[model samples]
Target chain A: MSTEISIQRSVKPLGKDELAALVARDIAPGSFVNLGIGQPTLVSNYLTEEQNITLHTENGMLGMGPEAVGEQIDGDLINAGKIPVTELPGASYFHHADSFAIMRGGHLDICVLGAFQVSATGDLANWHTGAPDAIPAVGGAMDLATGAKDVFVMMTLLTRDGTSKLVEACTYPLTGVGCVTRVYTDKAVFLIGPDGVTVRETFGITLEELQQLVPVPLKATSAVGV
Target chain B: MLQFIDTVGEAVAGIRDGSTVMIGGFGNAGQPFELIDALLDSGATDLTVVNNNAGQGDQGLALLIKEGRVRKMICSFPRQSDSWHFDEKYRAGKIELELVPQGNLAERIRAAGAGIGGFFTPTGYGTMLAEGKETRFLDGKWQVFETPIHADVALIKALTADRKGNLVYRKTARNFGPIMAAAAKHTIVQVSEIVPTGALDPENIVTPGIYVNSIVRVAGTPAERAA
Candidate 1:
């Protein structure tokens, strides 16, 4: 079945920073958040000082700050992406086991990740392209996907070839099953649950256009508007 | 009692061929480069190495992998911009890879240290990584059973070590040091400073003396340079 969502309909789709700001705005104050590498890392820039969010990096740190500058950079101080980073005032360091425990033990409130594909049922596939000759590297993607209280995905709505990343079912290898709670895309925002995928909002595109791009059926919510 | 050694060569001298070695690092942060170089010099091959990554640029673990010393890599992320050596070896079928989820890798190493047999985790449930593993519905979620990863030798880097072998680390460089120190039969550490027993505060000791077997002072580490 299809439903219509009164879209924001921006002249241009929400840019990377805009999407990050949207995600940051939705995060509850005082939440513990983990931003995955790549695009998800941009979300941290939109998080305001008033938000009081504690950042967790799976490489054994909590209260992680922004990327370090020249004098602040240290080989010993880096995030999961191996980029040198600074620590917040209340930062604490632990071993790898304890760091992963923070994720796997359900201590993290929210985590934003980038995905290759997100199924209607919320299955996530981001780690491996499943290419035969490619060396597969599954970092903390699976752990963060399955372990967080709420998993939000950030990505462009379609691949470079214009194929929808939101699908009826993920064709690539699964990182975690039914783990994604919300999807923040350049074209739209989707909420995935047991009932079905819901179009929370659309950007620079109508609900009809979004449906044409996505293979899965969508139900729209008029909770948000431009 | 922790033996204080002078040379990196003597620190990693006991690692034999065909042993499972856990190298402590999350990238180059806490990697014991001197110990790895010593292992390379000692001509120990056929090693099953465990770390968060396979290797990065052409140094340390990358150098060893380039020299065909590692037979298998048990790690989470092996593909990186500078991981050409691992990529080439893996593509040529000269090396084997066991890619575990990051949290599972860390927890398994911890289980080995904590003397736990096995534990169930929901991290990789219903994913390719959990295939063929035992599954159970516990705590209202499907969890996969994972076993411990014990190491024959562990080479780690720490910021400082006391006469009693208590160790402290620098920031995120503490990644796998404390856990790897306990998970291995013999743990060798390279530290910037070797202080008197009471020099390190009791409350701040990350790894106690019991987990450390040998300690070597590496004079020119970044920690020392900064100090």
Candidate 2:
């Protein structure tokens, strides 16, 4: 298949923090959320101080907080990405199996994950690329993908080469089928549904302009403002 | 009835060729590096090793695999950027791999310890990973049956242990250690020190003494590393 065609316009990509903030605004208070490693990890940094979201790290933490700030850094306390973090009050630790049980038992209300490509029908291809040198590292993504109540993908709208990551079908090895519920990107936000991808909101572009950046069909529903 | 071995070599003496071993660690955090070093000298072959992250960056399981001792790896994530040995062996068909979803792998080990035959999970449901597995709709979602994973031996690293073999693991370093101790036929633990039986508070113990078969005091634990 031919690669995604990009018609560059005057849109300046949103900074990393903006993309994270956009995702943070949607996580309902008191939601049990698991943020995938990498870009998605930044979402925790943007949540409002009043929100009572319970962050989870599949490695073993249930109520993880932001990166610790102090000379007393306990490197042992880390998120699933193995980055040092501080635990919130009421945080509990358990066996690795129990941690996985929380993930695979459909207990997580939401999971924000980084992705290489996401299909219009909400297929996720984040785990393996099958690159000759790429290591096959399939972690808890599969469990979180299927187990979470709603899966949100936090990623850049386009790859470094200006190719749309929103595709008709994923080329990489899939993590889960029909798992993505929404996507928050540097350019725009999309809701993946049976009717295909719809523009829930855009950063600084019009509906017509946002349509030009994506390879998949963009549906503008009446619920865009909400 | 307490079993405490003095040397890493003696702790791993029971492990044989072609044995399935579950190793505890997420990356190098809780890795029994000293025991792994001792195994390099044993020269065993055709072993099936399991863990979360594939070892990388100059030590532990990565180095052991380079010595041509492991035949297969059954793990959740089997690749790190520096895991060149596994990449080369996997691409060349020299090594085999069984990539289980992380949660599934964790639960399978737990199943073995819990005396459960098998259970259904929705993790791998419509993906390529779920191919040919026995799947049925459970409460409106497709679930696949996963069997328990029992290993011949388990090599685990812990922060501290009592004379009774009660283990206490530190923070994220406690990743797979507890479950692995219960899932293996023989569980060998390497800890910073071995305290007296009553020295450790029962509330602080993560893995009970019942699951541990042997304990070895490893060098360079947190106390040593901090010093």
Candidate 3:
């Protein structure tokens, strides 16, 4: 007896900012979120206050706001990166221990982190390159990855060399396994599925063309023209 | 009854060379200096040290690195301070370093204490960190594989402790102490004071005695270790 196989078509990609907005829409009101350092940190500026989201920093502040103007900056009140920041009303200070408890105890609803490579299986590898000269720091990315209820990866879709950051499997040392739930990229957003990476939507490109852009083999199916 | 040793040198007597040790504190805020000094005097080499930060400029764990005792270090940021030893040795390829993101380091230790083998994360995707590891997709995004971390001994500090070994830390000193206590096979705590067992309230205890194997009370402040 012969067995039949089926393939699915790919989806389009979204711009970096557009993907950020998409992630913002997914966050529920009153949710506790951790915006990781670098690009993921930019998501804080776009979160609508109506959502009532409470931002947390590993450095011991909660109910954090985006970076403030020079005059408004408080030298003592800063985030984990030591960047000057503003605190929203109802904010309180706690021991750094409590701040980490909120993270390690899995109390956070969402954690958005920048990425180096996202695999088809949703593996993360953002810290330590094994480079002899590199400083070798993992920061707080590891905790946020494993502790958050949901994780969203924010990064460019491809490297400068045109290589896709999303792959069939990660080749670098892992930070967490199967912790990511969604991916938002400059070109497109892909959902890592048991069947493989399934494209949810795209920004300016088409499905057929996206297949050519991605390094991993696309599961071909019907046309998903957008 | 809990016996308080006269000096830190007598407290760390059983620790041998090539032992895996977890040190407490974030940056240099709450390190166990007395215990570190004793470990140094013991001349234990080939040590695998785990901590949040390596301590500023050869003052804390840097002393170990300088003595050529440390074979490897697993931490979040090793050079967050002005430590010449880390830069000089790391540059010379003398020390093996595994850098864990701060949060992940905490979780990995906690996971080991909680009896979990491995957990998932999405922190390192698309960077050099994703070069060689297993990955999986959950919900819709990418997450990487991060294994648990554990140690053979934990050298920790506490603001206060009762004779029963219930610990309390002041401010940032509590950084990795509680979790380190849980992750290590044997935890030796150095504290400023050791009060009666019932003196510490259950609510205020940071690390329960169940996780601590021994307690040593320092006579002087962490700064007086040299004297």
Candidate 4:
């Protein structure tokens, strides 16, 4: 709850591309991954060709290529975001049912999503803010949260008001119950599981500083590094 | 037998008010805009429409909602930056909404087409959406029961079709088209080109003629097609 707590040491939080590249490096090669529409989409830009990662868009395609430009912009060819996109070589298209089946059936290995809040026990709340006036539009957030083998979240550690998004329990309406496996944030990367929140790596803050920022109890992994 | 209709008006003719219609598309891709416009012209009202989003801008489904033709919208993501039509109608209590999860929506439609009664899935379990649904612990996870979504008519766009009504879609525009064609009682399609029967390769055919009711050839709309 304290916004004024500052570490004596200088620490700059990871840049947007830096955070995205960090996530890209962690994905296993040849894995099937679905990146949620917003911030998670940045991870795709950091992916290396050798990773051989196949992108899955909930709308209905596998082997999705990058955003389509100029002559390549086909209305029919698009990502889940509905922005025009291209198809990679060896790409295959299916109907909506089969596309979701790829996720719900556990064929997808990893999915990265942006979150409004993530509970210590891995509960995810990203779809709706539970506001009365806001129109509720939950696309594939629930499906991806509960369906993927591992649900990785990409979000800022704190809101602009300096409140921690990683909470003991989600204040927003949950997208999935205890479904998150890892969270990649601007401040630190956390691995959530039965034991508790583990600080895998920190960007600009120390484990001790992050512990003070987040409400949940945090433990550092033996592998923690800058 | 599939009939090649000459006009969008004739293609969408005979749709009664209060009918459940499935309009295939993910956003604007694969949406049968001409057919939707024709349906609008037919003066059908109080219809329950199903699609991914409620509507994007003041066109296609958006225009229909703007005209107050749709009574209810069954979709996953109805809120977008450009979804002002649905947002206004929803806020003003002029429209009804059934916000199903994307996966469940797709599966429910598929179940209807496949003639399945109902099935259980973990997509919405333990969430607000699963509140009243039956739940069972299956395959090491809690799953919620969901039923099929059948429709009186379906409007879909595709790239190419043969005289037999075999379909081949262009890229991601294929979303919801195949399942919707099967889930509806009558499936009306608009294609860029329609070839003679047996012109389509059987193996490459996405939706077979059996599921399709009628077809219309729409010369590529200048704005919609790739430049």
Candidate 5:
């Protein structure tokens, strides 16, 4: 397991399916959740029907399944990301206001989102990068991060250029402040709290190795290989 | 009272220049394409358009902007892979954009229909979006005040509507239609089917006739309507 996790800088990153499976392993049963647009959308595919966890898309569909296959794609069955997906049993359609009301009203138990960077203090910066040409893509992220009972981010620990996403402060325009609760990265899982970001689990590396690799110094805890 | 209008041109004729209009859709799913075409032909200019996206293709609201009809846009998802029109015009500073958090955008529009002045939301509390807006920590959370977005006119699409203007939306494509209908002064709905009064099941009606102003019939079967 340790050798398998030794990622070369030039090697391809872990596919979203493996990351989704990792995120899905910890979700409690009977929780209503919303998966964010990108990598977070894959989390729904890993959940079992037995979990009884309901999925909501902000564009007005609840009880969605994985993305629809080739012929199964329906133009009208798009999720919030505008990607086609299948619906589970007892699926329902709603108006935009009511759907967002469910989001902002804090009915979701958890929201899995993809982030550009997360601060040590749980602030999130996903809407815009620190670039002039970057369009502000503040879709439903602000609402999801702040409104959900818990916010879990799924992303790589490092950017493609090897910059650590776990930082002292995020430079990108914030989607919300102190809203993130947990982070599921390709390398490890972090719990963001008032004290700061802490490692809950790592893929196969020790806390010392991860600390050396990242930009920020780690408050090394009993990092388990979960 | 029957509110089904004669044609798309007739329904869009009341739209004046500089009117703030809410067009319903998440992308093109529930877009009122025909009404937009008519609005384009009518030469209405300086229009403030509000919706979820900044339009996708060369036609529709994007076309309205390409023709320089739109002065401003209030939307949540302002960029898409194919949203070149918005990207170009916005970069050129020719068109203005007010990016809203999607939930806040929906709630503001909902607030208008519900007759609420404004509300506080935890979203955008400490972000750049909260700058200049009144904010406070309430119940152990930071919140920002969002005002209602009341549009002068609303152009929406529905799956089926009765002559009395009661609307029933399709599966997931029903994004902003009902709420936009409620938040605007005049709501013109384009539905694939127009049934007689009391024909649609009352239990299934999403937007009651009281909120809707008029309905336009689009040529498509009920099955195709949901497609």
Candidate 6:
């Protein structure tokens, strides 16, 4: 039998700046987006205002703008995390029931979420780690993950200890199963396909170099660099 | 008429122990203190309280925790306080604690009010949250089905109410009061002021009188009263 050749054996690494720029480039204009807490929240500030993207918050606010500046902060207009925020010109307020209706009813076009781990099959685990020291809390990340039309993950490729976050399976509690369509990381952009992790681009590193970064086995198909 | 009561004690006369109560608030913003006081005076025990957060210290729900009346608490979190009796009891396995995600807790209450049996959401999958939960595949993704939550007694706060029980809330204090009003079997509201039936504008009434079973007019500083 002929030996199978692995294409991902040679891939490159990407820097953080390149990852953020790639994320910004991919966000289409006029999309309804929900940014998760922490780093995902930063995506709102970087979004180009000319794109006409509307932000929906689960905490009963819609048409959200970037975090407020000195005079624009409204105590009443806040995000799901209870952080003070600014309202867009056409912002509207309603009972939170309607806000969740929009979420569960599949009205959101895109949802970017921060994750603790992403499995090879695109399963997401971001809430609790089940560690004794971990806080027992799972926020709206669950609803946003399952409800949004497209779920995109934003996280570092590896842990502080150099453990690869993109793994064969998640060890932490999962937020959604097979919900992740794309992943944006400090390393490189990857699309989770049925075949395996497909590299869209490696910021500065080569395909072979990037393959070395992940401890898990990766199948590099012809789709690499696409 | 059974409408007006001077003290919270008079309003909570028939309430007994082992009651499942829904306490309104998002954090400590809109808790119902008058009813809590009345429950304290009634010496009710074995309470199952559903609220956004446990009161800070001896302030809101903390009072009940201090009194040793709560047998179980279903809330999002307990903030601003340390050494709470309920926390101690929870740690010692003396009480039951069901912690829910803040937004999910809110949706469960709202769903009960809307008369829906259950709704499917993809919030908690492949985690401990998925354990004992039914999941379905929607749009090529997994979603967990969460059931609605209801309560026997709902305690709420209102900025102003008419004699007929039309209610209005001031600001963020409006958090879960309106929804709890519909989800509870018996809803009792503590109002700062009570006016004539027609005094409140139709547009200003946040909660119509139909869902309200009783009204207690509290006389004190806004901070002295809960909610």
Decreasing lDDT order of the candidates: 1, 4, 5, 2, 3, 6
Worst 10 contiguous positions by lDDT, candidate 4 chain B: B218-227
Please give, for residues B84-148, the per-residue lDDT of candidate 6 as tens digits. 66666666667677776555677888889889999876666665766898989877667778889
| Residue A166, model 1, lDDT | 97
Give the C-alpha lDDT of model 2. 0.83
Q: How does candidate 6 fare on TM-score?
A: 0.80
TM-score of chain B of 3: 0.92
Residue A125: error of model 5 in Å? Answer: 0.7
Q: Residue B168 in model 3: shift from native, Å?
A: 2.0
lDDT of 5 at A107: 90
| TM-score for chain A, prediction 4 | 0.94
Backbone-clash count (model 6): 14
- Give me the runs in candidate 2 sitting further than 4 Å from their true place: A1-13, A68-75, A131-133, A160-162, A194-196, A212-215, A223-226, B223-227
- Per-residue error (Å), model 2, residue B56: 1.2
Residue-by-residue lDDT tens digits, candidate 4, B1-227: 67899999999888999999999988888888888999999999999999999988878899999999999999999999999999999999999999999999999999999999999999878788999899999999889999999999999998888988889987778889999999999999999888888888898999988999999988875237432
Candidate 6: true interface contacts recovered: 0.25
The best-first sequence of candidates by DockQ reads: 5, 1, 4, 2, 6, 3
What DockQ does each candidate score versus the true complex, computed on alpha carbons? 0.62, 0.50, 0.16, 0.61, 0.63, 0.20
Question: Which tens-of-lDDT digit does each residue in A1-226 have in candidate 5?
Answer: 1012232331333566777876776789999999888788778767876778899988998888778898887777888888878898889999888887887788988999998999888889888875887777688889888888899999988888988898889988888888899988877778887777788766656677788777665664653532
Per-residue lDDT for A169-226 in model 4, tens only?
9989889998999999888889998999999878778787888899999999886642
Residue A184 of model 4, lDDT score? 90
Tens-digit per-residue lDDT, A1-226, candidate 3: 1111111222334445555666777789899999887778767756786888999988666788778676865444557665667777987655444676788678999999988888877788676565666677777777777779888999888888988888778776677777777788866667766677777666567767788888765553343444
- Indicate whether candidate 4 or candidate 6 has the larger TM-score: 4
TM-score of chain A of each: 0.94, 0.89, 0.85, 0.94, 0.87, 0.85
In order, candidate lDDTs are 0.91, 0.83, 0.74, 0.90, 0.84, 0.73
What TM-score goes with each of the models?
0.96, 0.90, 0.64, 0.96, 0.93, 0.80
lDDT (10s digit) by residue, model 1, range B31-127 = 8888889999999999999999998887899999999999999999999999999999999999999999998999999999999999999999998
TM-score of model 2 (CA atoms)? 0.90
Write model 5 residue lDDT over B131-154, tens digit each, in one string.
Answer: 999987887887899999999999
